[model samples]
Target: MSTFGQYFRVTTFGESHCKAVGCIVDGCPPGLELTEGDVQPQLTRRRPGQSNLTTPRNEKDQVVIQSGTEFGVTLGTPIGLFVANQDQRPHDYSETDFYPRPSHADWTYLQKYGVKASSGGGRSSARETIGRVAAGAIAEKYLRLVYGVEIVAFVSSVGCVEMPFIAQMRNDRALEPEFFQLLDSITRERVDADMVRCPDKDVADQMRDEILKNKEACDSVGGTVTCVIRRVPSGLGEPCFDKLEAKLAHAMLSIPATKGFEIGSGFAGTAMHGSVHNDPFVNSTVDPQGKPNLRTATNFSGGIQGGISNGEHVYFRVAFKPPATISQAQTTAQYNGQGGILAARGRHDPCVVPRAVPIVESMAALVVMDAVLAQNSRSKSASLLPAVSKSNPLMYGQPPSS
Candidate 1:
């Protein structure tokens, strides 16, 4: 299933170390404004070697638009986008081609495909996410313009370093642009500042010092990313299948090295009773001049009820496993099925949480965009159904004249 979506479809192609990786998006509405600039910022955020917290693989990751747009506007056709790979070091991987890295996809890929690309985990590499991020950028633009929906994600936890809860941050007024700027400035002062993207100055400093120590020892750690969505309209998902949360979890888990996912009140909800867990409704208002609004007094349901959006903030967290390519020596087997031990080499991250923030946000955008398109189709279908039924008559108890 390289293809995804029932309405706005996206088909990804190419491999991690192939000539290039790219995507073709079908079903994009025509006349939408788009350009390379729109997608570049996101790709830059996910590109490796940006700082000390990720693999030292430096890729320019410049995007090329091949088709489906003209004069900076979409043409209602399949949009083709690509990114060429530069700075590939096939030699770095030649030695380990025979010995699969522990906790990586090497063994599973071989069992399924008989043969696999020997360099850089081939299709299994996080490099494949370039295409996804590019496609997701376009989807995000559409979502914002049509729905005023906004998605923001950040590294909330790295191993033991956790950012304060949103409530606490808000209460502290830490979200002020100037306050956040000062926090960002302080982080930039450290050599390994990006090891964890936590906004707390003190916690970030501690995280950086710890990461540097681990880097010196050639070890790695894993952590989680929290994504928040605001102003999402109601009725955004299909029932029985393709629930909003289900689609989000599926997209997120597809990312390389992602091991777990939870939507709003996940896992922790087990501690509460039914009454405490439920999102109780309350009388609310939408527009000042319009009718009263609907809302939940508590968001235990995470802005979603019965697999459909209930007009609350939709948020979730995704957990990533430690990068398998640690410098520490480990037990493994040779390609010839001979058992042996090997130490992995190459430029790898001590922690991936900082870099993973953008990837999580991209996947979240992809899921939300698909759900929005599905909702649009359903609305159009319902609008026409009544007229069609009245005209055909056979659609109801009335039959055509004999």
Candidate 2:
């Protein structure tokens, strides 16, 4: 269960306070240009101590490519990646020895594993997501070079503050081309312009203020991350099971602190009648390659219909809860279920939404890359079928009579 994806198998190792944290990415197509430089950008974005809104754990998180490549080109083998932990203060989390933090994984981990790491939350810590972000960077590069696919995620909401564009789009019940155009135009540069990562300056300022206020009160906050995947082909998912949206949900909920997952209209669609919810298909103009495409007048289906992609932009949102470990005193239980007062004393994020943007995009890329490989294999297998008809008889010279 630690590994993710069918075609792109990513196995992560190490823990929060361990000597290192890294991942192994297998099944990548050979001859692709890859290096530590290609994998470091996302790692930097996911690293802590970058801003005041996150924890003050100063870690360089420098990634080293241990194997599976030479001359900066992939060899179609498992690529090993590692990043050493520089600022692991195990003593900061020693309090867990006495009491389990409220709503934290401390108790559940001990119950499931019988023994848990005394420092940090071990595999349950958000630090473990470094592997996903690193491997996802590789998957994203392949998707971009081969399929022209693009994935972007931003802080859609922080606590009660919501981005204006998202709120307006939801209120108007319309997804205009201009809106998608804006969504497509967004770059990591713009999203990272501020510490809050909202891409909307006014709202980002407010979100930052909210986080600061929470930090002032020795508390924390949570919000949502909205991701958009563009230029994905129409037929990249299975039908009966392993639906695209279902896979997306599985990947998202697996992220630490993720509480909810929604695609397209999500929970809001239940309010509208089927007539309004259904996307009316329309003919799409030919692309530069002179290939015909399909378009939908409405995208309530979120670019996927019948559990597969329809060549429209795939968009979704993830809900994250506040950091459970807070400086404020909390009345929680101990390992023996004894109640006591506890005040968590360690570096923690005042708000996680600002840092979750890259994580959401990375997870989305893994899902899409895996689905594309499956679809490609299925198409090749289908193409291998010989021309079969009465003219092409099997076994004997006579065709089977029906």
TM-score of each: 0.86, 0.93
Q: Highest TM-score: which candidate?
A: 2
**Index of the highest-lDDT prediction:** 2
Which segments of candidate 1 are over 4 A away from where they belong? 164-195, 286-292, 386-402
- Against the true structure, candidate 1 has what lDDT? 0.77
Q: Can you write out model 1's per-residue Cα lDDT over 42-157, one digit (the tens) per residue?
A: 88877889877678888889998899999999999999999998877777777677798888888888889898887878888888888888888898899889888777766666
lDDT of each: 0.77, 0.88
- Please identify model 2 stretches exceeding 4 Å from their true place: 165-178, 284-292, 387-402
lDDT of 2 by residue, 74-129 (tens): 99999999999999999998788999888988888888889888898789998899
**Candidate 2 all-Cα RMSD:** 4.5
Candidate 2 residue pairs in backbone clash: none
Measured on C-alpha atoms, candidate 2 has an lDDT of 0.88
